[model samples]
Target: MNNLTTEPDMHTALWSLVRNNNKLFSQKRNLEKFRTLLNIISENGTIEDLINIMSIFLYGNNAQKELIENTCLPCLRKLPCEDLPKLDERLRSSISYAGWNINETTDWKQKPSLFELCILACHPNGYTRERAVTALANHYEPVALAIALIRCNDWVSPIRISARDTAVNIIARINTDELMKVWIVFDRVSHGQRHGDISLSKTLFPLLRERIPSNELHLQLESGNSRTRRYAAEVMWHTHQSLNYSDLQALCACSDPYVCFRTMRDILPRLDQRVRTKLLDLVKTKKWAPARLERLRLLMTDQPECMHDELLDALCDRSASVRNFARFHLKEHSDVDMELHYQRKLESPNISTRIAALAGLTEIGSPIVADHAKRWLKEENPRIVAAGLSALPAEVIDNCEDHILKKVTNHSLQISKAAYIALCNSPPLSAKITPYFQRDDLSERQSIYFANLLLLQSRWEAVAHAISFCRHNSKEVNKCGVFWLQRWVYGERKFWMTPSKSDLQDIHRELELSHSNMTEALMKEIRFLLDSYQ
Candidate 1:
């Protein structure tokens, strides 16, 4: 110790002790040297001298924190630049221990300086910078919040998240005079309210709801980006607060299903016992369920028990994503059989519910459930109508004979295509739908339907299916298959034909060569159809 002549020599020696404070402190000789070094720095050290000594102990063993905080923190803050790294460490220590209301309960004057906090907030090190933010939030000091606001745009994700979180908490705790300053800081943020997550509607509403006009918040709720709308919903329900019933109802729309679903997840659990049931009842209207795919997923994931009826309705959701998820949940989790679930949802006013139930029933190989699904033919939503025409079982199509005859003409081509697919998909439907072509009331739509149904041989490949269709058991169906094959083979209407001459010849050769599965009647019919080309 006596051999060390310069201040730098002692500084280097002190740093060595700080790094190995616990290990060195136990030895009698090193402890005497460490105490002598602390005494020399305490008596006559420069800002850098004080900082070097203070940081050594501050970061050393746990037993040294009080000496650094009580003996060194006061003199260090006033240092030039405070040397940014050391300033950062100070802020980190402050954030870890500062009381939320230390300003009021304590002398309130001797806390970490706001200037130090602001500087640390802008520090390059993300780790210490986030900790600085936590300190600002805890201090809830009015002035440091500006730095917090700037951090809302932090380049790193977690830093930005921390800044926004602290800003909200600070704003929530500040006085009106100080809180008003947030708008000024926000004004400087690029596109301020237009951005996601950073918008006032999101970052402010939950914390500063009392200051923001309710009408403006509602407007943002309706028109804001998904994140803004999400937060607006959170604020609205923070203390069981709510927007108008219709607005709450509107939140369930599909345009922003993910957001709508999240808001509902939070909102549903908080409603009064009486209103909760009514809220569930309102969702049953189908309009609520229509576009909310995101809602269904979260509901199914986090709180499946709350979504029982909605899950049932979801089995018929217009969105395949929702319906698929619902079916998965029911099949894996619910004891309820597919038949019973389908029958229950069959009468839901939600046309999708009805259609989905029918689809679900048919999927699990349930018998024809045409009565329940037939009503979907008149559903205004084209999706529901399309599902109705196709998702039914084969016998269901046979029983709802008249309804199919009528719906075939008036609905969309998508629906008509669906009907073609639906009728042909079922063997029973093959017999049932064939009879419709002979009807006197065939409109152009009806004409298209019958023509397509009769001409359609395979849902997958046209030429190959045409040959197979010619071999169908029913004579009318076989005759119809031949007629369409002739149209395709001869140059009658090029639009209806898909197979080339070579492909037809190849099929003919293959058919004659392989006659085992080809019944005598079907082979004869195919031979007659092929004779025209020959």
Candidate 2:
């Protein structure tokens, strides 16, 4: 065995053992041999040999196995651009087997192979450039940070956007005032353009405080795109020692719901009752988009009574997102006024308002509310009726079983599809609904949806059936089946035994002929895992 191990041909030695014995190399012993081979390669193996060995291990038995940290990773990191393409291919192959743990590779940031990623990003070929950008972002190498920053200004907008987002994330981790200034400048330039994102801008502001001059800052904040100006007001509300009369007037009168929400949240704690009352008035009258109003509602949760009048008013906001917040906050108290507000929406002229009202009623968890929904199911508009049924609780679910099953079997595809989703969600839906799988009336997308729902509940027998339904020739079904299967496989790997060789053979056979998007996705994952070992 020692003589065989010393042979120049690493693959030949491993193959001999695999072919000759049932268990000559268990995972533990195989791991040790892998480490030794890695060391030998790091010292003397050619790149061609390395790529070959790595590719073979990928998408095979070694996919789940861990790589031994030999000096090769650090050495490979220092390899030149000419050597990067080979290494990139090998890395993709070995992803399954490679330990992504950053600490393992010594001086990993200083590696030249990492720089090769930058070259790939700026590669002449468009597809190669896109792939390189993705590969670089995913690599998580700290040394690539500076290069990524430069690429943010890339001539191509798409590449620049990717690079900018990557740089923002990397900068976020540094958590220093200096980095914040850089982000603030970049954000200003990109504001109202394609790259402006509110969440990222708000985050950079607080960090910029001590680094940027206050006088210069206030001017920048008061101007710019609507989103930027709103965030600026939020910054002033947080950092201003004493709100100047002008600042107070602006903060009080700002029309953006986010600006108002942030002001209320930040200043309410520090202001006198007189000021808080003034701010509450601003919240009530300001026409806000639904999402921002939701934030204000959540903020009011600690003292709902203080702003009850305003929150109740928001329940009628034209935006469903805002109404969602209203229902959520209002339900926490469950007062008569809030329930009355919901009841009115149920009869409102707008279809979305009716949908929001049903969801709101469900959130309240009242039997009276559930009963109301059941009555609405008899209405002519099937869509509204379907939504009403969807909002019903489990106990209510049992009572409506007959009606729901009938709808599932309805000739109208929309009605059937909606019924299928609702029934699958309801606990009373077991075995009774299982027969629906055999119904040829069901669309492939509908079947795929059910398959995923079953997988989520860990109903393996049901999941197995669902997997078979993946035969629906739709790309959507194939994509969904493959995703759920991969998730199922990952979960099984954690708690279950390693898959048998026969199982791998079965998957490989299917891989060759299957047209499912999932098939390709699964193959990629399997290959990534196998490559990790290399």
Candidate 3:
């Protein structure tokens, strides 16, 4: 046999096995090549390689059957059961029918690929997978059984039944050592969705709780995948497995957010005062926003006296939710002048702080917010200008309508967009922006914004503006015009100020000229409106 050490060599070996080319491998040499192939696959092959190997084992010639029994099956048994690759839809459908060909009377002596069969239990093909599940019955190799457990959630009905039944029977009689090996796969599968109401894990949890040792559960909690760690934490808590302060601290520091949150929620309350305080302090330093927010909540409810400083510090947290949470609780608990504090923060060099302060002051309805907004609008920094525009009150906007209108054409799209949005709220200011509709230099988005603003007005001129927008070069703007025209035509006619007969005739004339842009259906609706209204 060739060494098959390099990638191309490996590919060639796998291709030979797949084709079952007897010329390449004599009877003895085939066994050696098969052993080497399984070793290489188990060590470093990707999911594609595994699929290829399974194809050969399941359907390849029986020349290497003895080698597969002694070498291939054992190597497969050790393969970790995790999320499998998605198979092609065409292949899944095709193999489903192929499963029917496996004779029902085939005895165990004839089928030696038990581990391969276990993997096939999850094959994309439903019937093939169901047949795999049937073969997996009474087989308790740790990885094999775990794969069967995963099929409990299979989208197919009979496969789910067969897999669940197999797991139920084996779990009842399976020993602790085998169960331990199955634990990681089992815990992971439990978190996934199921096909029916039957959950073998829920039924088996108490049995696992009794049979699995405490040390093993702790090991799972300390280190594993997110799903396994989370499940371990739940099992430990529900089973009342005692965790010392260090264990609690480790769990609190877990990278997984839910595990950290769950530990704090379920376990922290019952700990001694000193331990809880230490844990809270530890969580306060963690960068995760949810954890920090949760810590603030715990402080507010359990230790209000210690909450004042934390609340003030949290007011500037990078996360908006954290800052808002702190502000909401600070109002009731602390007598500090929040408005004055926010006003001071507006001058801070940090842009985020300035924005947060502006938001807080706006929410508090501070009289000084409008003055700050006026100043921010004139600043060279566009972000500051945006914050000001967003916070600028409706009355303030009405007074500065001209200034706001000029900003709609600003070079900075952000500032222009903010100015456009500000003007949108003041319907009386819509006339000032009507001239902007003719400006060809505006971007597609700005053109659309202006068109939408015109649609908001109840006046007949707004309908005329919609018609004029139809001729704009941008297809999206033209589409916007067509949509609003349809709405105005189909909508209640009496509610809006009716166009004079001449205005109606003018709109009808514009629609006739816009035939290339307007859909036939829309033109029909417009014609119906004009004939009735005239």
Candidate 4:
């Protein structure tokens, strides 16, 4: 029979060699046989012959097997392509899919021979490059994903966005040690999301601890974004459980109110009376909401020696809520002497002292001060209301929108303008008052405030409308409109800026081609607005 079912000497010899001694590939004779199998694969022989030869070779020493599979098998499968774009789509698809299955198999160590073949097959085509990116992203190896993202960034926008999102996802999941690897990657790249970088760095803070570079965390705590400050405080708190006095001082002095409050609140019990008094002195001048600062006051009772002077002094603070927190903590922790001392500071003749006393009388601040603040919301005196504006809760200012709007009709222009400014601070105002631009009843100040908000949000339609009203006789209103328009064109301090000359020309050309009159009218408005500025 042609098949030679029982007497195929060549097949029997190769199989017997592999079976008797898996290390046979290291011998000169078996090495020649492996080379012959690779040659057959190169010449378009059956893949079955190549697979059999690979099995024999797989049992050899790791180094030699790697060499044959990496160097020889890849050479056998190399495709012929006249151009990258003309590469065979079928080959690319087959190779990419094969790589996925090979990578997932339990015998992955034996599959690099095949995986090398796949990588070589797809190296030429654009489709292969995109799929390679997907593979790199989904692969379990973090280092591999980082390399692929960096390599793919220049491909196209869709590819770039995919790579960036993948990089972010990979970075967020890696271990703290792996995070250091990613940080080096971060330092290597010229650009990445600033917020993302800060976040990743914050997460890796402990890995950086007490090393010379640990001071970098302190710097971030002092000056980075709010998220960075919050994370830095958390990391420092965990890393330095019994924080040194100097480190405590640094944390306590942080400009971010939350960070300062956390540092004082966590360490107050552990600190001596001297350190406690220092923390109390610092908390007295703070202007942030009281609930956060109240935790620091609670710690004062554990150090009774510090509360005597600290309690009396805090009872005289300008912020009534601060005084109330001090009193509550003292009453909860200290003896009667501390309470009477706070009461005496409350009764002092100084207006600030009287304000402080009133602060304690109502268990927070005198309800009367808040009532006065509410009344001053309607006051025509700018200076008096400005003080009240500092004390009023954001919610009260927000709920009193219509009342503040009526104050725009107040006799004094300065007071009217301040009232309008206050309205801009209200969260509900952006919703309630943006529609005022559509009405004819807009005042000069109201129109100006509306225009500023529109400019701030980059609302082009509103900017165009406000520019149309610059022709009104009121120079002040015209000036404000021109100011915001220029700001829109030039960009704000932390927002979008005006385009360059080339960009402006390109936009003007596009506008000219589509809507010539609209373009001309807009350009005319821009010119008039600019002249008004000068």
Query: Per-model C-alpha lDDT, please?
Result: 0.58, 0.54, 0.70, 0.51
TM-score for each predicted model, relative to the true structure: 0.34, 0.41, 0.63, 0.37
By summed lDDT, which 10 consecutive residues of candidate 2 come out lowest?
Answer: 60-69
Please tell me which model should have the higher TM-score, number 1 or number 2. 2
**Candidate 2 structure quality by residue, lDDT tens digits, 48-139:** 65554443333223221224223334544443323544455455435434432223322334542443454345444445445556556555
Residue by residue across 1-534, what tens digits does model 3's lDDT show? 456667657756766764634655556766677778767665664555555555554444445544544544555555555533232222344345445244442344666367547545655657778877777765766766776777777787888888777776677777878887676667656766555467654566656677776667667776747767877766656644555565677678777788788778878878777778788887886778888888887777788877788888777676778888888787785568888888788888899788888888887789988899999988998988987898899999989988887787778888888988887777544566678866878887777777777777765666766777677798898888877777777674546445697778767777667777666787777677667666
What residue runs in model 3 are displaced by over 4 Å at the alpha carbon?
Answer: 1-101, 112-131, 137-150, 154-192, 195-292, 315-328, 331-335, 428-430, 459-467, 482-503
* Predicted candidate 4, C-alpha RMSD: 19.4
Candidate 1 off by > 4 Å: 1-150, 155-206, 224-228, 234-255, 286-364, 370-388, 392-411, 420-534
Against the true structure, whose lDDT is highest? 3
**Model 1, span 270-292: residue lDDT tens:** 55655544454444444445435
| Candidate 4, 1-534: lDDT as tens digits | 124333234445545545534665678876776555444443543343433444444333453455446544543343221111122233445444434333232243332333342342243345444555554544434454344444333345444455555555555455544444333334333234323323333333344343324555567677656765665566577666545666666676678988877666676666677666666556556666562356445645565555565655666676666666666656765454543554565446565664444434445444455565676555454655554555565677777776665655555666657666666664343455556555566676666655565545435444544454455455666676556556655553345445445544443444344343233554565554333433
Give the runs in model 2 whose Cα sits over 4 Å from its true position.
1-235, 238-260, 268-282, 285-365, 380-383, 399-421, 427-447, 453-458, 493-534
Candidate 2 local Cα displacement, residue 461, angstroms: 2.4
Between 3 and 4, whose TM-score is larger? 3
- The best candidate in terms of TM-score: 3
Rank ordering of all candidates by lDDT, starting from the highest: 3, 1, 2, 4
Better of 1 and 3 by lDDT: 3
lDDT (C-alpha) at residue 314 in model 3: 77
TM-score of 3: 0.63
